[model samples]
Target: MTSKPEKVRWGILGPGNIAKAFAGGVAHSRTGTLVAVGARNPGKAGLTEAFPGARILDGYEALLGDPDVDAIYISTPHPSHAEWAIKAAEAGKHVLCEKPLGLTAFEADAMIHAARKAGTFLGEAFMYRLHPQTARLVELIRAGAIGEIKMIKSSFGFAMPGFMPEHRLYAKDLAGGGILDVGGYPVSMARLIAGAAAGKPFAEPDEVVGAAHLGQSGVDEWASALLHFPGGIVAEVSCSISLAQDNVLRILGNKGRIEVADFWYAGGQQGGTGEIRIIRPGDTEVVEVKEDGWLYAFEVDAAGEAILGGKQEFAWPGMGWADSLGNLRVLDKWRAAIGLEYDIEKPAKRVNTISGRKLRAGGTAIPKRSIPGLPRPASCLALGFEDFRTFSSGAILLDAYFEAGGNLFDTAFVYGSGYTETLLGQWLKNRGVREQSVVIGKGAHSPLCYPDVIGKQLTQSLERLQTDHIDVYFMHRDNPDVPVDEFVDAMDREVKAGRIRGPFGGSNWTMERMDEAIAYAERTGKQKPGALSNNFSLAEMLEPIWAGCVTSSSDEWKAWLTARQMPNFAWSSQGRGFFTDRAGRDRRDNEELVRVWYSDKNFGRRDRAIELAKRLGKSPIHVALAYVLAQPFPSVPLIGPRSLDELEDSLQALDISLSPDDLAWLDSGSDQARARA
Candidate 1:
């Protein structure tokens, strides 16, 4: 006799209306069992009653932390799916999240990243795709049952008689809309059919044009879209919340058409029969599909089997990471065309009550420079506080900087694993100086360099910085794989929404890439990058200190900046401690300094700087920083200081100014050349 397979114990993240259906499905699934139900409000109407045999947990996090729960089914609202799916993946549980997996492709990418990082399974719960009829339809289409497929038409919608604005169906904060709720069905079906015709698991639409009727609550009520797929295939998909639709799917071909009524129930609704009709010239055929259980049970069983088989996602139904992300990309574009936006996705202006240590208007003021497109003048020196580990520790140096009239703070998402931003937020909130401070938010670092991550990371950064708008946002790294226009459009959306004020640009992008991005923005009538951040110092870099790093102090780069008059925020502006006496010429003693900035050419420049510093009675490091500030174009150098003393030492560099002749001599140590200039 064969041994029975072990059942997968499941946990439900939310106990709501749709979760009840998932509970029913789980109960009927052969390889799945409902072990726990997590309810935010345990006293709610449907917790114990909907899931009788399952343990009632107090919160979603509690359920995820439970050891007995091997898998989690995320049945929360669309906006909450990404967060909890990521949490579940981090907790090492297989995840089955509801459709419209995320509000945007960025969220989907983040969730996918989490799952892949944790080595866990994560599948979107498009239960209808697991139905037998969907499989048969794909098989027949590939077998030429529908010869030369050309078009697909699908829709799903329902009429709510008494639509409440506060209901999840109409609340923008809850990510409620016809497109995110029911429109995913039509879009997914259309993509699946197109993929079938092309002999692939799934295919993304090439072009999408969408229009919507938004309700008073600002949520889409009725939306329609036309998608152009590969091989000249077109699909007309529609969805509605206040109006009823046919709720059917049809694929038209040159030889025949396949029609599916109530396609979302293709596995047989509650143990009933599903029918697909084939119509050709002068002939008609009916195909009946039978099921042994509920329609949703198939997805539950499939998820469990994939987990048992050590698969990250379902194979036959094709609810993998790529499919989920591609579907979200199409939806994101469609929503963009229709102008349907959720308020929850917007950056909120945080208002915190101040308690201690009030800020004064005027003090030891730092020199300010005006960058194009920025409403306010920025301090020429920005403080890099990524290394501060605690609020108390960061607050002292921050207080000293602010009191000294330094306002700009540079922080990135990858900094201190987000602790740096949180500390900055706390300090700003405590001091009530958010309005006066200039926060430079950097995001989309290497390996996470997708265009969608720009918005997602910016949102998180804003929340952590205790402000709605970043004065100057920078992409921390460049991703050559993605087109420059896509990056431009992503930043444009953030700018239009008021999340970023102006002067957004790239941190380490080459001049050519920056020009390409600016041209694309100008051609598309979008905002162009107004600033750049690159390495610039008196001591030249022999190689990149880190991967994908670029320097703006090269002769060619400096000339370009001078001609364009662009602002370049110079990072490592003092040569990463290369100008100090602690760095020696011996490559074996200081390998990092030698590997990065120790070429014969750089050593010669350092010698020139040392001589110039001796003549001017200043530190060589001070001369290095002063050299950066005295450039032909706008140059703001970033300084990372660990304490008040370090900050004061850095501020001393502001006192030393370099003349054009002095800069020329420092570059080549040629006194005759300085005279010629």
Candidate 2:
């Protein structure tokens, strides 16, 4: 591991024109020093004369590992930004990469996640934002220089006199496009203005729509986008490589307008006059922002100070983590609107994690347990990933889970309207971990609950999941109105037909019905329910969490599960945030938490869990999850984590071992006297 430095010793990854400009800024920086320049080949020529003191490394990898370097500035083309940024973070080097942060928001998210996992700094290099001029502009707008802001108009475009296919600006293979290149400037500024109007660091567009003309190379040449923000503020942003635009920023309000020419560059690298013009109906006011600081030096020092200050991100005026993510998301939408997709965004190219490394063997292995009829043991903790909308988003998380020794995924026919299943399938195929993984697919949910609909929905689910057989299939909801015989026979037919090749069960089913189905199955020689998926948490459910939910936390139900020894693929295993501090009695904001896991008995259990957690040096939520894992029978708590932090937090339970007495006290407080001993 690299030691922290008082002054950030910076390394330039790609010594191109942008890197040279930034090096000039570093020469003027207060808290930063240029230490090394890394190139593709072993050349001591171009960058050395520019900076006589800096060493020239043979390759980017060498620079990343250089003991003298404290941080890295990635000035490579747009395509490699995410990859190198992630690699730098993995090497424990702070990263400041040129924008856009990634070709798409998904890549941006992965880069951010990688830095977080590595405990390093990662920032998008938008030097304009770190300049004092931007702060003043925001301050002026906040002071109502333009009262009741209504519209924003900004453009950053330049005409390439000759559109050579090999040029970085026009090359399709390089992810060349107006939206992904120069367009981020106008969009980011618009968001900053919109955020100043509303009271935040930055705001994402509520709606984005755009149109662009694709060149012969299948990349967007020029594009225009309209962003609708909150409070009826609209922003018109445009960019191009082959079209000459005014390169101006205009913020119009109800009473006046603020205008700036070439706002991004401010004055020049050396700084001259950055004038902000306010034009009212009858008068014109000019605010001159003048400083001798180099334009890029401000960003270099900003990153240096943040790193030395032990901050993972830059302050407001500069793009924070969320701010960069929001900007990239808008760019993604704009590119999507214009049908601009880079070759890298395709599934064929996105098979690996953004960090290009597996997350397994990270010192903690997710404990695995065997399920009936599976070829191999699966993780005790199952992941329900229904929130991701894109393949990259889902793949990143899935990759983390799979590499962490988690081989069970909970998916459904109705998740994301089948898009979730499609993404999971893509991840399974991409990762080639299908046979090693257990997929719990649920279908025939409420409103569509029928014996006959199961097969049809299962077929569609199989197709979406790109698998012919589901390892662990379940009926999402039970229909008592439909005879248990029909349900059992239908499931048996499917089992015989090999649609469900592993454990088959029912989710949200009553214990009485499950027993009845098992009896019927045994009597008729059909497949009996192998597992159950119900709400089984430390806190008992008082009311339904959702429309049709069942809780197996009752004493009788626990006794039944213990006696039968059936593995329950429990949902909402963390009590749906019940054990968390957010579930206090006074915090009734979450009606669902109040409705389902909000009784005096459950609160008493929560208190006991908290008390035990304090003794165990863990959180009440961790104790709650540990209680589930220590059940008398097989209990695989289905955990849903949207990000790496949440996933790591959930994994903390794997280290907590709750004995039978501890579990008894957590469940009923009967063994508390012995537990404390």
Candidate 3:
């Protein structure tokens, strides 16, 4: 905290009608003052009349650069919220963006990340959430006035007289829709009420389902969604621009129910009285909230106080970071269920990262090395994001990787049952970085592990990836029953046909099987298997991690890999939490870890790793990863980092230079560099 200011100087960006309401609210705030109004054309914007005595800055960027502006109130179109909010944070200005902080949860997450990175306050402009009326409602719910809430129903809607295709509410390119506009009022309230009933700040719905009437302009004119929360509470929410709704909120419980008419306009904009009625079998109660301040004034003050307090976000009851993220996620799920996606979220429109940065090369944290079969050099770590469900969520990490000089991605047909492949494909296509990327595609795992299925699955994987060829392909698993010729012959045809441009190998094939396949390929003049993906780490696997999984950590297997100079795209390169102190001989809670990695020898190796990590001034996990990277052969470790922090943590291994002696000591507390002299 630098110093608490008497008032937060505010600048309003995109001085439209909403800005008028917010600007009026600023006049009523105790913690804020109007500094400037930012617009594209300062001369014709008429800021003199709309916001008299306020400086008019030409262009949004000008406001961001203004040293006098302490905070920015972004009232831009829905699609530009993420852009302006991030830019403001980067420019060292606090951001209080208009509600529905972003069109999607991904955008909200990015905005929050930027705020956190910059140490600036960021808030969603949900005025009702900060109003005293909302506080009283929450207080009543928590006090059990409604007697164990079970259900909530709310609506916000109004009719547009005629079809106005070019209107902001109907324009597809502008991200015009009822759900993104007003649907959040009920959803946010429902979550808040549910949280109050549960005695928490907020609660997210377990499931969100919706139905929308898509107008001719391809925007949701009216929509209704159901949010199912934990403990059997349900919320029914609706919003419309082409039709009028009651615009009321109702909470139902076992003993009684509460109703608030026009809940969204609580305190009535320019300040008046708002009523909440509680009804029971034979008794009735009414709670009236009175305030003399404008509605948006509460939000402005809330943000100002948070910034002045050196906090990065508003406290509960206000739309905090997590609350805003949860609300946007609910909105995303609702839109997905109703198949209401705007053009901007599509691949064609998302040509850059949400940060709006185009990926550039050569500022690498993870170094690149050549793989025999890949057309491009593979990063020391092949990113495995097999759990991603959406493009926006996954692309953030992908963009970070690409910008950090990572060129390799690992995916399989079996992962997410092919959704992972599609997501990877969408990310690559949207980012337009396929030419510089090394894609590791895998197929034919388990129940369908056959030579013929390899080609078929490869075709499907290619289509899902939106690519004509795979850089380095692999059969996800090998079938011992099938002849080596069948597998060798099948993949050879793919390579010859230009479908597999790099080396095609097996993910979990045994050493003997791999050697036999190599011999068969050489004898038949076919493309030879050039890589093996097995579990390799400081502590070797004692048993199969998966049904057909293999470990190349044994002495003979390592010797063969070293002699052949074949690359091992090792998965679980860091022993899958073996070096993390949480895993030990006493702790057998993880059955897979116990079943596959537990042994007296492995425990000694783990201890030696901790000791060596101390000497190297790094963590045991970093030492474990470095051991894999510093292997004698062309070994590329595949790291599956689930978040940006984890990705950065994995990159720490690249900096640790592990010599052969260090590797030998990490593998075992051996006096000799090799297992035996």
Could you tell me every candidate's TM-score relative to the true structure? 0.58, 0.93, 0.91
Candidate 1, residues 1-677, lDDT tens digits: the string is 95534998999998887888888999888899998998889787757878989999999889999999999999889877877887888889999998878777766766776787688999998989888878988988998887988999999999998689879998988988899998888998899989989999988999999999988889999999999997899999999999988887889999999998989977465777788899999998998887778988888999989998888888867588788878887888888898876876542311111112245555565777777877877788999987665453466567768878888888999999998899888888777788877888899998999899999999899898878888899999999989999999999999999999978999999999999998998888999989999998888776799999998878999899999898888999998878897676764577778788877777777887787678777888888888898998999999998645567778778888777877887787777745643
**Model 2, C-alpha of 426: deviation from truth (Å):** 1.8
Query: Candidate order by TM-score, highest to lowest?
Result: 2, 3, 1
Q: How accurate is candidate 2 locally (lDDT)?
A: 0.87
Cα lDDT computed for each candidate against the true fold: 0.84, 0.87, 0.88
Model 2 residue runs over 4 Å out of place are 1-6, 44-53, 336-340, 358-364, 671-674
Candidate 1: worst-modelled 10 consecutive residues by lDDT: 347-356
Residue-level lDDT for 397 in candidate 1? 65
Per-residue accuracy of model 2 over 1-677 as CA lDDT, tens digit each = 96666678999999888888999999899999999988896464656787668898889999999988989999989978888998999899999999988877767877888888888888889999999899999998899987989999999999998778988888877899788889999999999999999977777889999999999888889999999998899999999999999998999998899999999899888888899999999999999999889999999999988899888888888899899989988987887687777776566777667676543433237978787777678898999999887776677778878878888999999999998899888888877777778899999999999999999999999999888899999999998899998998888899999989888889999998999999998988888999999999998888787777899989999999999999998888889888887899789999888878788888888998888788878898998898899998999999999877678788888889878887777777785645442
Separate clash counts for every candidate: 0, 0, 1
- lDDT, candidate 1, equals 0.84
Q: Who is ahead in TM-score, 1 or 2?
A: 2
lDDT of 3: 0.88
Count of backbone collisions in candidate 2: 0
Find the 10 residues in a row with the least total lDDT in model 3. 668-677
Give the per-residue lDDT of model 3 (tens digit) for 1-677.
76667999999999999999999989989999998999998998467899877899989999999999999999989989988898999999999999879888878877887898899999999989999999999999988997999999999999999789979999988889799999998899999999999999999999888999999999999999999999999999999999999887999999899999998888688999999999998998999999888999999888888988999998878988889989998999898898877888777777777767676777577778877766677788899998677776677778778788898999999999899899989988877778988999998899999999999999999999999999988899999999988999999999989999999899998989999999988887888999888888888898887798899999888899999999999998888888896698799898888887889998988888787778768898998888888999998888887656577778888888877777777666778753431
